[model samples]
Target chain A: MQNEKMMLEIQQKVELIERAAQAGTGIVEIGSFVHPKAVPQMADTDEVARRIKRYPGVEYRVLVVNKKGLERAGAAGIMKAKLTVSASNSHSLSNLKRTPEEVIKGFGECADYAVAHGIELSGAISTAFGCPFEGMVPLEQVMKVVSCFREMGVKELSLSDTTGMANPRQVYDYCLGVREQFPDVTWNLHFHNTRGMGLANVLAGMMAGIKRYDASFAGLGGCPYAPGATGNIATEDLVHMCHEMGIETGCDLDQSIAIGRDVQKLIGDDRGSFILKAGKCSDVVCS
Target chain B: MQNEKMMLEIQQKVELIERAAQAGTGIVEIGSFVHPKAVPQMADTDEVARRIKRYPGVEYRVLVVNKKGLERAGAAGIMKAKLTVSASNSHSLSNLKRTPEEVIKGFGECADYAVAHGIELSGAISTAFGCPFEGMVPLEQVMKVVSCFREMGVKELSLSDTTGMANPRQVYDYCLGVREQFPDVTWNLHFHNTRGMGLANVLAGMMAGIKRYDASFAGLGGCPYAPGATGNIATEDLVHMCHEMGIETGCDLDQSIAIGRDVQKLIGDDRGSFILKAGKCSDVVCS
Candidate 1:
């Protein structure tokens, strides 16, 4: 019963995340707030918020889908939260089952939640780079998404290349456009390695002066919608890239790789990660 | 019969190469100078030289084993040749069956051939950063190996992080030492993605001012000695990195990926490459 798929326990999720945070997990994305009837896995955000383990330097963020989700996060003492507004009109409708107008108005409520509680908010524009259903995601459309979120007083925003369909050139062009528009607004890159060019796109972001990025340990968190899409770039792999470029990540590779293994084992899937299989090679000595 | 691996027929190879050049096969490695009995595939150095489909823009490089190998290259009318002296002494013994002393002495002989034929040589110190047989390859040994080739008037060199066992810190430190030792020498890098850090090492290489790199199409080439050791960095992947980062590669990723698929068909191995499976993810929209 424990290993059975679709038999996931919400309480168990709270416990696993608590242990994962204790075991040195970095950048754990706690939930994707949607309809209670839609994604049952994300149903226990309020309870999970109360049960989560908070590391000294870790950011324990909860996903807020609407005013109700934000209010629940606030009630659970989850101060900071992530809010998303999808670029694809169809994706927005299917995910939240709300029209784009409803979604933006809903985020207007999120801005109210932020002002009342001073909640640290990270606004994200999903499918900013591309969409599985719609095909091409325009920079203009993404900019409009961010522009609305910005007007609602949202500052730190992430452009999610959600479907693993973004190329590095598009990343460069799109990111450059965003950076030019935002100037100093903080943005994180959330790219899926589904097409294997995630790291390449990361490089594109770096060249565009992007410092903050979103990476899941062991490359976890695939799109349930896209058939073969994997999660964001592996954290260890990303940190390895930063470390190799003489950039400071302040994270341990060995520890990260270990957690990646743990997450893989917990998920009961052997289909993830490049760093764990290939240990750290940045310090070999040939004599 | 036509598809057999042992067939590097003179006329056939020349004709094939002529077409390959026309089809944009710019850097074709003609042959390695290992003993004819050992890597029998490289026995056609002379024939390759005699009937080369010489193209002014493209490079035709032969790998030299010893002084005798250089002589064969000269007679074959090759202009550019690569001389590799390993940093891993055990690999030196196993691959060349010679001690470091014998290899250096052979470099002296190879130099004589280069000077006699006006050949431009780029010395490669294999296992410069790591080795498979001997876990850690010493930096001094690599520099020493490089110095041996340098003493023979080989001013240009490429560092081979053989088997993808090198790390970025080591790459940075080692390249610093190499830069100090051979101040005016032109240097390139060779890396493998065995452990999934191929591009990380490339970032380190680019940081070290090493621009020219060696990558196989669809990540072709691996060691028969090391089990599960995959090929070098994929050319399309590398080109994508360069193009996205605003680095000029003078290569086309879409065309390269097409070539990769063609080569995969030719070799009958479909298990290589990530970008080929995932396709390019840059700004260029793909159908």
Candidate 2:
């Protein structure tokens, strides 16, 4: 029954990825190439990568923790791999069983492997804002990780609020600081709606001139440390807000909402999607 | 049976209001003095007003649609009454059975009654962002209502996103435009999380120099026009963000979260409170 459920989930993810590409998503993180025994949910990421029909002009990426995960990703014909580590030592020790420095040191081998295989590599710093076991991660700690990624030739970097403990002011200040310090690197923001500041943090990052953001369908995913927390900012909700503000995200709002609804049904519960529940702003009624 | 349930709800609300005041809430909108036939849930606002233990520093207020509602509020010994109208004519027609202009015109009598009875009156414009019956309400329409309120001797005003259709850019621009045009008016913002842009809009308003936000405990309030929608931004979530950003809101964050949890248990649902669900950012645990 577990294998059957995993197979069904893999097929559903493929369909969701196709629908997302059709809705004009520029990039999609298909899945993480993690140990199957540790995360059974992402056990079939290789199969998912092989089955997805790649859309032209859309980048497909996967999370890789080390050279082994990157090798698996390359074997699955994945072109882009994101190397991730928790910036805070407590989260790093808890989740990865190593300090942040040790994790980044391990990424050196992954970076070299990606370069040798002609695969694009980016860096992601998890718990860049705060950790469940530790309060706020210092800016110096995050900056140290960014500097390491830069030295490893990673140009695209993401600062992820793993526990949704980020405030707009903190986000804005951190984005501004990073951009000023690392002018050549592309910055992305990943925020969870844990404390309901996901969109607010996005707004702050945008004001600080950061563009790329990561969101999940129907607001799926949550922190294992912060139990009962909501997931990343909903993609449909984010697209709706951007379109309403005339920001031109190059996404189909209706299609995104449709995908959100489909994902909610697939999950057998309301996944905390705002646009999925409230409809688009243009969905006016004749009251 | 209905009366019994309502009486229980009334007692719960009194407890909630008293708890909120103890948690250092500056202003509390206790309830609406609308017709009981229209809104049966708020039928016992008079009783709620009479039963609550008032705090010395906190101001207790209620919503009043017209002179009749204002009179009822006065009879209940409520010193502060907020006269409300919809900025969008379509919403006004649907909810109030009149146009925005007509509603403001009628507020003249309300203003007169408040003055005669020594009741402090403020103005609130609902659907100031967008309306369910109309997509986007024009800024001029909102300005017209503000001008009327200024003429009616209402110095404090609140612009409410009734259906949560506001984007951050729109909020910032609108707030800037209104502050520039009406320099003397003290502005507050009321946003719903109908589309999950509530906190984002609040950030925009703050960036544009507007303070004084309205939030509900446990996020317990929804748009009747937009079914299956979330309510106002949770007060605990907002205070948590403010405290994290180093902005002092004079609120006790832990007490606010406790009240949110209590409200959720009373209502027998989660009610979409982030802090209530995830605990505070300070809630650290050993891994």
* Cα lDDT for residue B115, candidate 2: 94
Tens digits of per-residue lDDT, candidate 1, A148-266, equal: 88888788889998877776678878989999998868878898776556776787677778888888777777666544456778887877767655777767676777777776776
Taken over the whole model, the C-alpha lDDT of each candidate is 0.72, 0.86
Q: Candidate 1 docking category? A: acceptable
| DockQ score of each predicted structure, in the order shown | 0.26, 0.64
- Alpha-carbon shift of residue A278 in model 1 (angstroms): 2.0
**Best candidate per TM-score, number?**
2
lDDT of 2 at B283: 80
Please tell me which predicted candidate would have the highest lDDT against the true structure: 2
RMSD (CA, Å), candidate 1 to true, equals 4.7
Screening candidate 2 with a backbone cut-off below 3 angstroms (N, C-alpha, C), the clashing residue pairs are: none
lDDT per residue for candidate 2 within B178-276, as digits (tens), equals: 999999999999988878888899999999999799998888776564433357889998999899889889899989988888777776766767788
